[model samples]
Target chain A: MTVRDPKQWRLLETGLRRAAENFAIDRALLESHQAGTSPHTLRFLRFHPSALLGFHQNVEQELNLDYIRAHDIDIQRRLTGGGAIYFAPEHLGWELFLDKAVLGTADMTVIARRICEAAAAGLSSLGVDARFRPRNDIEVDGRKISGTGGAFDGDSILYQGTVLVAFDVERMLRVLRIPAEKLSDKAIASAGERVVSLQGLLGSPPALDTVRQALATAFGQAFGALFETESQLNPAELPLYEDALAEIDCNDWIYQRNRPETEAPMREAIHRCRGGTLRCGVVLDEPRQRLNQVWITGDFFAAPRRLVVDLESALRNTALVDLERNVGRFFDGYPVQMMMLGPDDFAAAIRSAVASVPEPVDG
Target chain B: MQACNGCEFIGTLYYDPEFQIWVRREQNGSLTVGMTDISQTVAGKILHVRVRRPGTRRPAGKPVATVESGKWAGPVPNYFDCVIIEGNPAVLADPPLLNADPYGAWISRVEPTLGADLALADFLTGETAFAGYCERVRNEGIQCERRTG
Candidate 1:
């Protein structure tokens, strides 16, 4: 087989598809690329109303199965890591399959930053001040607009993201097991405050073609490469895709890690410090003794506001015993000016939330 | 145990620098597999680890376990053909142990299917080999933390 120039990348626009097909293609492309049978590629995909979970996540812990079944939302597990998300045709998915050598470093964090910055730049070109928030989020003025995650096999890597072109906060809250008690107007309004969409920001959704072009342009500029559109998967990837589809499009694959919701309880607490009131929401993985994710939202004042989100990112997946140390370390190096509060206060707030839950019994 | 550039290395273990995995042969012929300290540092604090169940045979370079850090996720591949014997329950329960005490937090135990001569032939061993590992650490600009109390 004749090899294309390494500097030239393929752009595959596999428009609207179910989560199964999209993920199968993800496997096929990443495997083919790793096997040296395909060129580095960028793929754009759209999901048909799906509820997706991270590869290692427990479906029961992350989603409201009753609501998902009632609404007929397709459930699938992502090949990458992160929290669960609600995806629909209104959301645009972007992915890159490339050799790790192209990034010049084996540090995944650096690679994530570079790719997120490029994607954020693409969004910024669309007239929003999109910025790469540390640890896999793109936010415009502190409101998340895109979330990204990645997976690697040997020397090959696949990094993917979802851009909220038009998002439904209520629908997302319903699909995911956020607080059921928070289904009231106050909660929906508060949920709306945390995320932003292109349609919401621009008054109307921009053309899909325009968004694709902006992203393609940004990637080309960032990596100094030219992209050529590919109509379909390469011949070698056909069998790979078929096998992947057969393996992925099954109930077994989707519910492989079926931990109970009781193992992961969402706990919240309010702590009033000298600086301000800090409210923290924590999803504690009781069996594993870890914190899956934490959301800190309150009337806290800090000079660099992103510090709160960064701290939350640092605390993600932290062992319950190490929470205070991690929080203290997070602030030790970070230069932040909060009115009268210190890192200990943030630690205290998270600890308070965690303390509300009973410790899991030893097996 | 010996240290280089703040990264620890056990003298008796064999190292696959490319994969950043260390293998220790037990008296019972099973081998213990765990990621090197440099790897845990580079990958950041690990979030979750899921090992393939016992009795599952895998070919060389196939994943024995999947590991996820806060920002990245990937596999912990075996360097040789082997059948998994057991996964470390401690590491499975609290993944941060891989970051805090990687050597103690072995990922899995596997019995190599390859012949003894060929099984560990490619792995680096001894003091001279460990020096090379340290050189790679320096060359890669790996920053291993001096864990504070």
Candidate 2:
């Protein structure tokens, strides 16, 4: 397919590239467009096995470098927000390069939802139940089918995400900090509950072409435009890509500019409750003097699985004293179900952990 | 709020004569810095503001913080050495605040170990900052909060 007009959004498929190259191309296109040298684009890319951290994330805490190196997985940091994600050749990646004028809003969170909802409509057309989950994720039922993030400049924008046509939870555990690291049979099951894949949904991975076509169609409708396939980067973007790739592909580009990972110890608190054993992994955000990430797991049954995921995300990165307020606020509006599990139980577990260091006092 | 000499930079900016630099915030005798209004118009609608952690280290004349919007990402280039002060767990929570109050709701602040008062003096303000702001406003398509000179 050939693009005849610069205004017409172009669609291109860049076969699997290392994380750096793919991300560098992202930088190049966004930069070129910001400089008023490039056009709106839709790109389909695939990643060689890699674990990616968010732009502001600490590498040490987010990834399992040993597993990444031994498995020959590429590691890179994203230019967006949210948590870390594990990407590989098996998952299909999609990105939209457009001007913010198309969306009529400057808010990233709102932009994320509009794009996800449109993609959900496209996914729904493919006979799969897909919907946009708040704060920037697309899911089938309550399980995540797509995770996304975005970057913007001047008027040009790049919002991207991956759909798990095929994925491995066990491999992800090796690359990420799982809620439970016991590595026992129980650990694997626990990890499975937290993540789901398309293969598990369809009994086999969807073909690559089918996934791309669906995404392209989704994006086309989302933007109310037509997509004509192309084979290369825009000429204006080539020079920029080269420059960006040079910086990002090397160690200094990757690690030289980074801060020492925020090494908040993974402290655990076992609270004996009549209902069940509640185990919490509590971490502190030293900079904010707050409770960063918290995981509550152990023979716990919660209804509306999204509630658990939402609760975890709510408390995932919160301040210590702010814990009770956050939990209470989340329950105040969020529809969650745990017959015996109360907000106080949640607050108690977090309080027990915050009591240890007492923050600024000790350190 | 404690008395501090800081000026607001709207879509287009003006620098105060009394203060050479637009102090983002004053903390423990340190200055937090960021771009003025004239900067954001050129930058575009901020999609995401990614700042280093509070304890994150930095050298002067470095890209300490990064802001992303409309698919483009650029460093919030700084003119002084700094370290992020404790507050705001993640930039994602209130990224727009960077634009709403770029100087007040700063991206990050330097703890001012090496250069404090000296660097602040050299920072832009008055007719000089206003001139710089106008150039940015025109070069990068943007409207001003008030009619500029």
Candidate 3:
């Protein structure tokens, strides 16, 4: 069915909700849009302190349950794919529900880049020099401002992202098990180098309305469509949302993918490099022979400190066999200054962490 | 293996190009299913995979497995109504193996539901599989890249 108003789309503003409610809307809207009962939509959402896991992630593998329970933070799994993240009232969530035909490409990578570029444009309109980082992050001067991911069914797709308005890096560190040091001033500073908020980038946080308008307008221009603001879910979407809520609001659904913490072991290695002691903590997926995540920290001094985070991001989900080449490629293109540290030093740090594990027998 | 428009298709397996899934009928009347090279190429590097546990029953076209890549997550629909007999442990442990060896990595095994025949007209094998893949590649502008370490 062709769109009656090719130049028109709906803009949904669902104000602050609990994690389960937000995810319920995610399911209902994506399914309804795929069924052709709903129009293309750009939704703005807010959450009340929630710890969201990627759909396939295990809670124990990603979050600090004890702290989360103590703080009374809600937990829910996102329909989109990516790593886990901490959300609060200060963050703004933006989602787009459309079809593959609308994007004119079946390639998920290209689709992500296009959406992220548009989101980056919207952030830029807010006076931040935001750019789309490869894979799925929107950054300004190497510090990430927004992270995005997508979930698709048939021809329809739901792509969503978080825009940090007045972020609390310390609270995030407490919520997610990122293998970083405890929430100290130094650790917070380190976390701040990788993530930036609107309030942090600008002197003060922009109004929520202004943030929404900037993003909606930028998306409108990107898709060549006009947005008609809607405050409520359409009639066809309400029941669907309820059904989804019933399924997603319970622990059974949230913990459906529970895996043992032992499976994802944190292997730490200390490498005494010429520059400094480069310490690496790797979350190794032993059975897969893959690096689930990498964290580099030490008494090292590398100029443009964001490089460490960038290198860590580069090695995330990389195969053990590709470690050297991946690090080599990252350094080959990334311009950085270090007194005596080289790309091999980083590789060695990761290798040392991998060496902690015994070789896997053939299947 | 037969190469068609940059995609490699195993001659021994029956493929449904429209769904980008391949099925192999085992001697015990069970079918092993997995995504094809074209699907893996379009999906990019996979980070997580979850197949329906054994004893779960699903209709034809229903998802038997869900795969998540860097930016995308979606279902891997089966070609026939079946009850899952087993989920591949290796693929569950390491999803990137799907991209590394699409044909060799089976995601799940399932027995056909009652009254469902294994020989469906939609299933393509041998030369017909290559031809179907070729047509899809042309229409979809798909460029398959072999996964290399």
> Evaluated with DockQ, which candidate comes out highest?
3
Off by over 4 Å in 1: A1-4, A269-279, A297-311, A330-349, A357-363, B2-4, B17-19, B146-149
For model 2 chain A, where is the 10-residue window of minimal lDDT?
A: A354-363
Residue A356 lDDT in candidate 2: 55
Candidate 3 wrong stretches, greater than 4 Å: A1-6, A180-182, A301-304, A354-363, B17-19, B115-121, B124-129
**Model 1 lDDT at residue A225:** 76
Could you tell me every candidate's TM-score relative to the true structure?
0.91, 0.75, 0.93
- Candidate DockQ scores, in order: 0.54, 0.13, 0.72
DockQ of 2: 0.13
Please write out the lDDT profile of model 1 over residues A1-363, one tens digit for every residue: 335466799999999999999999998988888788989898999999999998888888889899899999999998898889999899999999987677777788898999999999999999999999887899998889999999988778899999999989999989987654457786677668778999999999998888999999998888887998987999999999999999999999999998887778888788998989987888888877778878787786886766776787788777778888888888889888888888888888988988876323212
Q: Alpha-carbon error at A147 in model 1, in Å?
A: 0.7
A56-135 per-residue lDDT for model 3 (tens digits): 88888788888899999999999999889999998999999988888888899999999999999999999999999988
Q: Residue-wise lDDT of candidate 3 within B1-149, one digit each (tens)?
A: 77767788787788775748888878887888888999999998888899887999998657889999886788886657789898899988778889989989989988888533543457788877777888888888988986654
The positional error of residue A153 in candidate 2, measured at the CA in angstroms, is 1.9
Ranking by TM-score: 3, 1, 2
